[model samples]
Target: MEMPKEFESFAEARKNNFLNVKAAKDAGKKVVGTYCTYTPWEIIDAAGAMPISVCSVSDETVEDAEKHLPKNLCPLIKASYGFAITDKCPFIYFADMIVGETTCDGKKKMYELLGEIKNVHVMQLPHRQNDPVALSLWKGEMIKLKEKLEKDFGVVITEEAIKKSIKVKNEQRNLLKEIYSLSKLDPPPISGYEMHKIFDATNFVVDVEAKNNELREMISGLQEVAATGNSPVSKDSKRILITGCPSGGVAEKVVKTVEEVGGVVVCFENCSGIKEKCVNVDETKDVYDALAEKYLSIPCSVMSPNTGRMELLDELIEEYKVDGVIDITLQACHTYAVESFSVKKVCNENKVGFMNLETNYSSSDVGQVRTRLEAFIEML
Candidate 1:
């Protein structure tokens, strides 16, 4: 169940292991609330402020939310309302404005909940994702958000500011991408679960440059050792292609499980993993177009007419040279989970060996998971 000594140990957030608004209060960091898909929050951090990704899932009943929010709102909304109903989230409440982006059903309702709160400004994103016009409007919204920050927090947003931020953020994104590429190796230099930790902690840690530099060195060192082929998988490893929902967990876990079962993960087919590299952004064409292009090209859980997912699966088989596929479904994530059967049917027709794994908050079913994975690897 444990990884090699070279890999970092994983830990979850403890009650006092984090800041309860005190970090922002003490640092005089202006807090801003942003619902799902506000990649701009990274921009906000780059602009010299703290952008809190409002998880808001800290409560029970969705009562107080009924006023502005609809009755049948998504879990994320109900959870956010649950937070407000249970206790005052000073971080979000203290925030002067809230930015909402186009993500899914859960995030849309978040905008309505913000209306019920006093002194909370709201920015609405477009329904279509990665659309050229929508991206422009969002960028415009960011401009307005900057204007507001200047007025309220006295922080001026300049071209030099956003452009510099884009570089830093892009560096982080690219570094993560490189880390993902490493998983293609046998016994992979890393695991899918390990990759999740890096992605999740990406925003939590303080020193981005130091951490990234450390990771680059570690991976590079491993690659060097691996240059002569010192990998986990030997000649007996089975290579699998993975496609599923945003592994809210890490993509490395799946890769690791494959290795554990005497298999290898040649490539990933999900958004947070290998799916990201498929996007080649040409910022020179237009910032909005480039941004939209980045998102549009990725293989996502949902697609219109439903051909994208199939195409991605087919290509993954050829590209990764994998023997099978693993589809990860988040607990109660209806949109992604509902499509699982259809995806499985396609995989079967195409003669691709695949399996669906369901999970909750805790990836604690290690024994059961390992058994299932081993069986799949054996079948492949």
Candidate 2:
């Protein structure tokens, strides 16, 4: 049950991460607040600014957010906007610039409102991934973003810097992928809870080298333990695959319910999981084309006819030997909410149990969710 000592630091890093961002800001470092994974971190890094996800995963500020946003909006959007309006999140508060993408109608509109208060720039994200026009538009947006960062930070984002950043970010992705792949083993070496903590804290741990090193060490330790048949998880536990909206706000409710009821989540098909980290940018290609190709390829439900998600789900389900697929859709996230049907179809085709739960960042439905998850896993 023992893990690498670095596991403990991830928790500590999450707690004091804001201070790190504050310190960076105080030291005259430019901080860019990113909402979606589609934002190119390499470009921001190349521009001499630190890119941090400002996505709020709590309902503490949802009420404040609802004051301006509709009461029925997605909690992720509400909480994010709430943090911005209330200046509750240090990442958003210290952000020199907030980079948003038109990933969804809610977020796109939210960015418009957010711009009224903060320095916000919205990228016109193309939803059609395979369309040539979409890639061109995305590439153009990447250049615009690069230009915006340069203009704001007074630094040129040279091609050389971007290439270097692409390598660095790719390295981080590969490390994370290796860590997550550890779950592919029977009786995964790490618990789903522990794995979630490591994955969630990735953005908070800004020191890429330290983060990568910690992951490498964790991987080594985990492989050793797994090889010795000393896994923290039970071999007979139901292997679950979570696919849906970002799970950060709802992980405590969902992941806990699964593990507490004799299930182990081996794959996360959502952004909080492997959705963004699974693919690496092609270093040989032009920086803009590579960024466009890699990001646009992400299988978020925002894309029209998101067949990629189904393919990814199929792959992960087979790879992890999933017993059930839990599609967690946030309230009013119409894209994922509606896309759940297709996800269920995919699960059925793969002969896996499928359960779609539409909820929000509120604990009010925790009991109900747990009851349903218990029934679902029991059925599985």
Candidate 3:
């Protein structure tokens, strides 16, 4: 089959940008949740609940939260808890509860304070993630989340419903995988920025099957405009790889900027990229078993390095013939952020050119960001 399209269009999503916050205001959906890789946001949305992908830095910018939050905390963490600390958190008042997980050091510390916010609930990812202990714990957490959803939104959490939702998520994943595969082709069918719009729009819109259908049409209609001679596809572009956890726009931006500056982003190994994978459920398997499998196999915040995350990235780099690497991490996501120095040093030692760009919210201080990106590109 011809390559399937990436479902979201930059123009369409921009036009409908107001829908997400509007749905929440209309009491149509209860959550604007923050998720790492593979967190069931689609399932939550499928339940007719409004689920906004959480931006960790909004609290500070919107609620004056930076005053109370430790300055060292990642801006996203500060933003998430900004309302609680400063009393201006719109999400705190609007959300039934902010369902959270202790995915990294900054989040873990921030989670403790959320308990004080009255309506917030937190999920502490197990220390031994992906192993038996974590698998069992996550299943229990899903159950608890189901109960919370029902209680908070009055939507019954049925096994059948979750199963249907899983199917939808899988379909979306398949479509995205196809899009990623297209990126890997001899001549990428589109530009890096064009691909980012697709990724971003998927998060905003609904109806997965229809979304994929749209994507298929777009991809089929696409002309194989080779990457700007700057994409990893064009051996001429500076080959670069990026590593980080729980990134969406940030990861995409890293690739976009690199491509913009004659650097080819050969591989992206963030949690949201390839490390966190979703498993298809067998009809014969029990629902719980299927659920466990889904959680256990997901490359999430904790599933780094150990769960083939590190190995998978290593292979992608070698396979893609990456010429350099970029570490995109949040300041508060201590696990990934603190590891930045190591990531850089190792890349240096390995003689792989690399740079680290830290961010709170993906969009912040464009002028400042432009300078840094330009510097990174010049070095290349």
Candidate 4:
């Protein structure tokens, strides 16, 4: 398939992400590696440090990680550990410090092992997001993170810096939301895989200004395509909404299989998808408190009461006019695996087609996944 002209720049940016990080490091800038969206990029930017997400989805590294990690753990954790220990990922190697969050037990335990290899600061994320004490504790954790960054980097993170960073990040979020809105159209200008790639590429780009400009250009290009009624997917294609655990490299396989079987993924409510871009930090309030509230607002499975995620999913299903919903959970990701029941229940109540797909990083299950996806598409 030919690449879209507007997305070309972003594709180039993704291709050179490692080089960009290396250049920034060589120029005397501190780079912080993170795994989850809950890690506030605004805070890292304010501290004069470049924050890059370090999640890996390649099956190639799983064997190396399996030597230490359990065989049945989440592939994401294993791949991440594999990349770190094998020195295969440049971003992980370039990071001056890693910010770990207690988003899941697998990650929390994996960090203990990771810390022995690299300098890691773990953030104690609260499970009860609705309680006042939980919010206060999270706020304190953000403050503690800020202090640690300042002490380690020898840079003062001023209020002005934080506000500026929030403004830039908010702009990015707005642009992403606009891009997601296009999926609601009768025939989206871009494919789901294309949209996922655009969002995924942003993880490595440290230059927010440049990324924002690229986003604006891509939006303009999409607008032109929409005006011409030119779409990458057929109008009769069955629209799908994928929700569950984050699928990094496997995202391409899942999306490709759906498309190949005559279904189009109109939206995603996963970690690396639209959910992360839906909320923005309020610059009007105290930046610290605002950051805490914004990050904590993310409906991660770790939260005790995660009904917010279901609410958000329902909204997207209606907004996108989805015909079916696919919940993709990496094998042994217990939290999301258990949460799949709630997603299925909600889908059944709404009379929307639902499929719970459980798989791992290896390509050995590609045929099985494809067959199941093909059957699901036929039902829709």
TM-score of 4: 0.96
- Candidate 4: segments with Cα more than 4 A from true spot: 1-15
Task: Evaluate all candidate structures by whole-model CA lDDT and list the values in order.
Answer: 0.59, 0.89, 0.59, 0.88
Give a tens-digit lDDT track for model 4, residues 1-380: 22233323334555477667878888889999999999999989999999998857777689999999999889999999998988777778878999999998999999999999998999999998788898899999999999999999999999999999999999999999998899899888988888888888888887999999999999999999999998878998999999998867688679878988898888989987988788899889999899999999999888878998999988888999999999998998888988999999889888899999998888889999999999999998
Q: Which ten residues in a row have the lowest lDDT in candidate 2?
A: 1-10
TM-score of 3: 0.77
lDDT of 3 at 122: 66
Model 4 residue 189 CA deviation in Å: 0.7
Candidate 1: Cα lDDT at 235: 55
TM-score of each: 0.71, 0.96, 0.77, 0.96
Of candidates 4 and 3, the better by TM-score = 4
Clash-forming residue pairs, model 2 = none
* lDDT over C-alpha atoms for residue 104 of model 3: 67
lDDT tens per residue, model 3, 276-372? 4424544356555666666556554354554445545556666656667878777656667656665665576567778777775536645566677
Q: TM-score: which is higher, 2 or 3?
A: 2
Q: Write the per-residue lDDT of candidate 2 for residues 254-334, one digit (tens) a residue.
A: 997799998999988899889999889999999999999999999999999899999999889999999999999999999
